[model samples]
Target: MMDTMFLKAALAVYFVSVLGYVTSIYVRRVMVAKVSTWIFFLAFLCHTISFIFRYLETGHTPVISIYETLSFFAWAMAGVYLAFQPKTKTRVLGAFVSPVTFLLMIAASKGLEGYVSIPEVLKSNLVPLHVILSVTGEALFALASFAGAMYLIQEGLIKNKKVSGFSRMLPSLSDLDRINHFCLMWGFPLLTLGVLVGSLWARTAWGSHWQWDPKQVWTLVAWVFYALLLHQRLAIGWKGHKAAFLSLLAFAILLVSLVAINLFFVTAHSFI
Candidate 1:
């Protein structure tokens, strides 16, 4: 009950914060953006309280079920956005982030609304660590691709000399590009670590590190795609459009691995 109450409260405040952000974008006001930012922070704090209560109720990490996992995933997305928003001069990004966060939370709250006890076989410590790390990495990639997409739109508007209020509200190309780059730079290593931990867990549970399950195989594919993004960004000095488009593509593949595999394929991950 506390979980549901707090979660609903957080969602309500978060929606207000999103409205503030959208209004700021349309009105082109820094003060409104700043207010929206603080509102977002408040919403995050409320969400954290819900998570805390959920954990106390469950006696374990509040990430076992799909909805719970998605909730945490949304939290990570907001956390990362909060961490850099002040410095990025990209308050306009709230236009994207707020909706995404709100949608994920909505999805999380739409399920059976009952606690799912963890299976005995999934009680391994590695399970929690793997989920947290993988979720965090995916959150980062999600932001990166969003930034990349924003970059393309802004770039197009600029090239066509569609200089107007909307164009002005968009973050500069350099800022968006930097966000895309920064997220990718960090996301890949985190994802790699998650994959490694997952493999370790697999070996412990099934006596085999490589199962070639749909989740495993597609995870490998996403990993390779991100690795290519990193290589192109670092080793090949790719930046701007090339990096942005590739990050977007990598994120799309990540969605397939995460959502498609879970829904369509019978894998060890789905079992968990």
Candidate 2:
């Protein structure tokens, strides 16, 4: 109940922050964006508190249900964005990030009834490591897609010579590209490690490292796709529009597959 209260508080603050960021974009006001970033940080703090309380209440990692998974994914997205702000000129990115965070929180809110009992197999210590790494990596991929989408918008505006005050508010193409590059550089390895850890857990619990379950199969597919994308990025000199387009494409496929796998088929990952 306490965690629910904190989650609701965070959601309300996230909504406000989303409004602030969107307002900053239209108003072309840097100060408004800065204030919105601070507001977003406050929301992140509230989300962190909520997660901690949920973990305490559940007596395990709070990622056992769809509600908790969405909550943690949103939290990871916020954290990843905030972490990048200090190192990059990404203040305007909150305009893209906040709306997604708010939507995820809204989805999470809808699924917040009933406590999920953790299965005995999921009680292993590796569960937290695997989930955190995989989810955080996915959060990074989400950011990369956001940046890619923004990059396309900025590119279109520039290419068509549609110079306007609104266009000026966006981050530079180079900056967006760098963010994409950074996320891919790190996200791939984290996701790879997550899959490896998950396999180890499978061995411990299911007596096999590879089950060929639909979730596992789809995850491998996503991993391979990103792996190739990352290779193209690092070795084949992929950047700019081509890289941005591929990033968006990859994430779109992954997102669609994730939803389809969860909804249309049964898998070990159905707990989320």
Candidate 3:
């Protein structure tokens, strides 16, 4: 019952956040941006409280079920936006970013009535830590992907000698590229930690660390791909569209790992 109420509240907050971003898109005044920021803050506060209530109701980390995973995804997405906006000063990205958060929150709200029942084998502290850090890292990568997509689009506009309007709203190409690079640098380590912890947990729970399960294999693939990107960025000083293209490819692989493995693959890790 409390979870249901929290879900409803989360949905409301998601809607308001989306509305605030939409308002930001049309309002040119500084006051409007400030106002939008406040609206986003309010929504974030509500979201936090809703998650807290969910935690209380579940008596554990609120990540046991697919519904809860979606909720966490929403939380991580908004957390990234809040953490990055001040640094990037890219209000225009909010117009795109907020909606994704809202959509995930809404999806989370859809299946909130189920009890969070962890599998007997998954009842360990490591599982929660792995999920939280992994989702948080993935959310950061998701934001980077959004920035990369925008960079590509804006770069295209520049190539075609088109500018102004939304094109003008974006930051310099170099700024987008820099931000994506920073996100990748920070996100990769966290993802690595999550993978390590998950492997440790697998060892304790199943007597094996690397089972080559679809999720595990795909996650390692993602880590390897990012590792290559980092190597190129360091050894070759890769940046600009080259780095952005790799970021885009990494995100595609992540989506496949997140969605395809769970939906189509028959494995213990297919928890979607």
Candidate 4:
């Protein structure tokens, strides 16, 4: 239970990092951005330590509860950005990224009161694998959406003939577009695999391969949307504005499904 302290501790550090990122954006200071990067690294380390404690106590991946899932999603997102950092000039992107992770962490903090009791159904190993891959894929889609949002902002500024200060700070359109494409290329397959594994787990837990659970249906909806996006990208060579718009639209649908359906619907897939 004491390890839960680490989760709180990580939340505090992440808040400070988010502030730093905001400041970096306001001042347009590269040094502040650099400092923010290290702070984010420290926050990520705290989150990792927190996860280690949770895993030690739970004897499973620490994504069973809504709190844990939010934590896991934020951590996976930060880790993905860090992994992509060296290859991209996305340091400024942290202004966008930190807020998303921080918001998830904040939502997660409300439930860190104590150890969460795992449901007997969640004891299945498939549950953890499904959670891990599925959340990671979702997290990647989040990043792609973030990048696409930035791309549109930059593109709009260019089209409107406005050479603003922050526009100079934003990454090139080519870079953001490439990141979106790469994320989709990778996120689609990972999500597909996640759905497949979840099917296997559903068979084990419910003795049926398909159910009309709102959560499951929404997840399938997200999968199909991503699949269509991928098909357009590969076959029709869609990129730039239309592709970015579709990516954002897909993420919006996924968000509605994950949040709205999970909260209001009487679905068997509701874990929160």
Candidate 2 stretches greater than 4 Å from native: none
lDDT of 4 by residue, 1-272 (tens): 75578777878888888899889888988889889988888888888998998788768788888778888999999998888977887798888888888899989888877776777888888888888898899999999999999999999988888867668888899999999998888888887888888999999899998898888888888788888999999999998998898899899988887788867878888754
The residue-by-residue lDDT of candidate 1 on 21-94, one tens digit each, is 98998788899999998998898988899899988887888877888888898899999999988788788888
Each model's backbone clash number: 0, 0, 0, 0
lDDT of 3 by residue, 1-272 (tens): 76677567767766776776677667655556566666676777777877787778778888767778878887888878888888888877777777888888777787777675667887789988998989988988888888888889889889888896667767789889878888898889889998898889988987998898887788788888889988898899998887888888888898888878877888787443
Tell me the lDDT of candidate 1: 0.87
Off by over 4 Å in 1: none
| TM-scores of all predicted structures | 0.96, 0.95, 0.93, 0.97
TM-score of 3: 0.93
lDDT for model 4, on a 0 to 1 scale? 0.86
Q: Name the lDDT of candidate 3.
A: 0.80
Clashing pairs in 4: none
Worst 10-residue lDDT window for candidate 1 reads 109-118
